[model samples]
Target: MAIDFGTCFTTAAVRVEQAGTAASGVVVTAVEIENSRYLPSLVCLDDDGRLLTGRAAVQLAAQRPERAESHPKRALLRQSAVLLDGGEVATAELAAAVLARAADEARAQRGGTEPVRTVLTHPADWSPGDLDRLVEAARLAGLDAPELLPEPVAAARFHAAEVQAEGDGPIAVYDLGGGTVDTAVLRREGSGFRAVAVAGDPDFGGRDLDQALFELLRDRALDLDPEPWQRLWGDRTPASAHQRSQLARELTLAKESLSSTGTVYLAVPGYPEPFVVQGGEYRAAVTPALTASIVLLERTVARAGLTPAELGAVVLCGAASRTPPVADLVAARLGRIPDLAADPKAAVALGALTDPPAPAGVDTGADAGEEAAQDAVSADGSRRWTVAHYPDEVDPELWF
Candidate 1:
């Protein structure tokens, strides 16, 4: 099982092994929420202990804002304790629920057959402790701890393999995600990807644009619904929050519309006129934030000791990678337009399962009898499920 636990989405793919060495690797990818295009990356355990995921969870959070908590990412950053109905659910546990949902999906695709090997993708800047918690959560959810990998590193490895297979050269990976935009210079290095320089932002993503769009909507919505607008200002209550939710959905629609179209014909419940906000105004308001992200990303590559002239094509993924201005942003920074090879949404998961773990213990020259019974080989030429204990090499305090 190879899983990509993204900020707003999660995906998993399984590998089925075959006998013939050449035909051994087969990749199959699946996602948790098939009904909805977007995975909310949300988990809500209702009063009945029923779990909700994806759009259902997000929808519930919006309806019953008091009982439900959404956007665990912010809480994870604040290190704030959550008081759930049954007990306190740690931020890691919330993330774990989301991840476990992906694992559950993987199991369903494989007909309940347990996966022996697994890999997990995480944000590049996440601390080792953060990685540990993710692994720990997976374990608690009944899956084995996986090989933890930075998302860009995984993407680079995936792209590098494709280029090398086709006899191609250096490439750049422009990973514009919902939460961040990461770009890496993927060059062939030692039969793998050498990320020469990588750049991204911890903040600044489609969500940033959403906020700007909300502000613009507020400017429009107030004129249309001056009564509700006045009611919201007098007090910060559930009614006000509900009104905000209704208004914000319009902004969200507008922001999403900008992905493929220049203008959004938006209608809010309070707003009488179905107004249109041209993409130009939207672009101008969000350029500063996007520019800052692009500059940071470009800086990472520039610092890695390479000029744009020496590079290859750029590859990108993440939910927001599909935005129209994202490629333009990369081109302006790198001075060369890039060739997009993979679907930004599904490519990472597809690539995740391409590489398989060589189960240790197979002896090429072993007798047929010995080979028949052998599972994996250890470095010492023996395999009895050996576990090599390396020094902890990590601070235990951080996990607490």
Candidate 2:
């Protein structure tokens, strides 16, 4: 079994042999949760202290905000305890609850006592410490230490096998998930792939866009009445946190709807009139993140010692990449239309189940300098840390 524990959502898959035959191809089926494959990465406790996971947790957050903990993954790097319902909740504990929920769904789907080997995917540039915490979370979730896979590597593997992308050159992966934007370059090797370069912005992606929209709504709410605003979201009020969570939930739904329409009119509670926002306004709010993602893509290619023309293909991963503005930016900046897998969100988990490439044969005829650089990158992959930089010279306004 493989689980893609996304910041905003999670998915799991189990591999099975076709018709119980040894020679049959492995078929992967998605584990269903709340009658859907996508599970919201949310955790919350009720008034009586009952634990709620996934969509249920998200719903509870709107009604009982103080007890809800959303976006726990973002808290991984912080040292302070997160305030939840007057208590401090450890980041690992919240992550464990979310992961355990996924594991439970998978076990129910399988209906067997067979010991399952689980693979969990993480962001490409996650530090060794972060990886260790993920393993601990899995363990706390009642699962053994899971095999860890980098998100982009797993994505590239899926693209190579499913798309039959035929090329010896490196493939570029543009991963725009709920909480972050990651760009990675991968070259196929014997039975596996080598990462040439990887970079990401933890503050960028769909969640950022949601916040931008939420701010707009908040401003309108304040104008409508500071009293209602204070009652719903003031720091000193009991229902303030709950109201904030409810607003966030509403705006997230509105943000997703903007993809298909010119405007999203919201009938927010306590607001005398509906809030109307144009799609263009939302696009402008998120352009900085989109621009940052393009720059990261360019930086990855340059670090790989290759021009955009030298790239085999640009593969788009994650659900947020489906947004039209992101796709347009990739085409305009990279000068190539990106290829998306069958299901971008599920690709990483599915790819984790793929076989590694066979070891490559030594090439005596290979260019000496190129081989040395490749070897260096491979070595760096096993090291504890690596730093990448985005051009500080770029104007901030250009991002939007």
Candidate 3:
């Protein structure tokens, strides 16, 4: 089993070996949780002080925002604990809850048989200390010291095996996730890939794009009638909070709808009419951020001692990479059309499972010795585990 615990959603995949047949091969399939392949990466504290995950957490969060921590991975980077509902919850504990949920669901799919090997993907720029915390989280979740893999390396592996781009040059991965954008350049060694360079902006991601659209909505709302908008912003009542949450969800749906259609309508709280937003307006609003991401991709390639033209392929990972402007910007800046994974959200998890397994009789524990041993393998051999260690359209009111 392989897990990609992401900022906005969690994905897991299981590797099935086909045996006793002439066409024996390995097939990787995404694990479905709660009837959905993408599990919400949310953790909420229940009335009993127990952590709830997936749809349960999301449902609870909608009613009580203070009791939920929406981004545990991001929280793990800054502080040891996060304050939720007037209590301090350990960040690692929050992360463990999500991991446990994924592992449990995956196990159920395998007829309650535990995975022989579990791999988790992380950012290439993560430090040793960060990896230690991740391993600790896995331990708390009852995982048997799973192997760790760098996210971009996994994406590159997927490209080499599945896409099979034409060239021996390195592959550039542009991962625009929910809360961050990571750029990496990786070269295939033998059966695996190694990261040559990585660069990213921790503060920039899909949420930033959402914020830009929200600002446009705010401006339009204020112009229509400042009184209701001010009331929604300042009121602390439960009803007001629920309305605010609904508006946020609606805004997100509108943003996604813009990717496929020209216009979408959004309903604002305390307003009788819906407002209109155009696809062009959203693209214009997010162009600067997309351009900046493309620039980072270029710089990462240069850091790898190669030019954009020298890259064999540029792969796009993460669900937000589905935004229409992202590909356009990449082509416009890099002079190459980026390859989008068949299911961008599950690429890393699937790729992690695709990695060559460790040689038999090797201790795959969360220990420095084992990690160092794995790192000693030849470039053509198995790669070292990076230790570880929807809105409907409506009549137009204001167009921004």
The candidate maximizing TM-score is 3
Location of the lowest summed lDDT over 10 successive residues in candidate 2: 391-400
Q: Cα lDDT of model 2 overall?
A: 0.73
Which is superior by lDDT, 2 or 3? 3
lDDT, candidates in the order shown: 0.60, 0.73, 0.79
Q: Could you say which candidate leads in lDDT?
A: 3
Per-residue lDDT over 137-234 for candidate 1, one digit per residue giving the tens place of the 0 to 100 score: 66656666466555665665566545543344556666666665665555553333444554456665666777788778668767666775566655
Q: Work out candidate 2's RMSD over C-alphas.
A: 6.8
The parts of candidate 2 lying over 4 Å away from their true place are 19-23, 47-50, 165-168, 219-231, 235-243, 356-400
Considering lDDT, where higher is better, how would the candidates rank from best to worst? 3, 2, 1
The RMSD of every model to the true structure, in order and in angstroms, is: 7.7, 6.8, 9.8
Report the Cα lDDT for residue 322, model 3: 85
As a TM-score, model 3 comes out at: 0.88
Model 1, residue 275: C-alpha shift (Å): 2.6
Per-residue lDDT of model 2, residues 310-335, tens digit only: 88789999867776577778888988
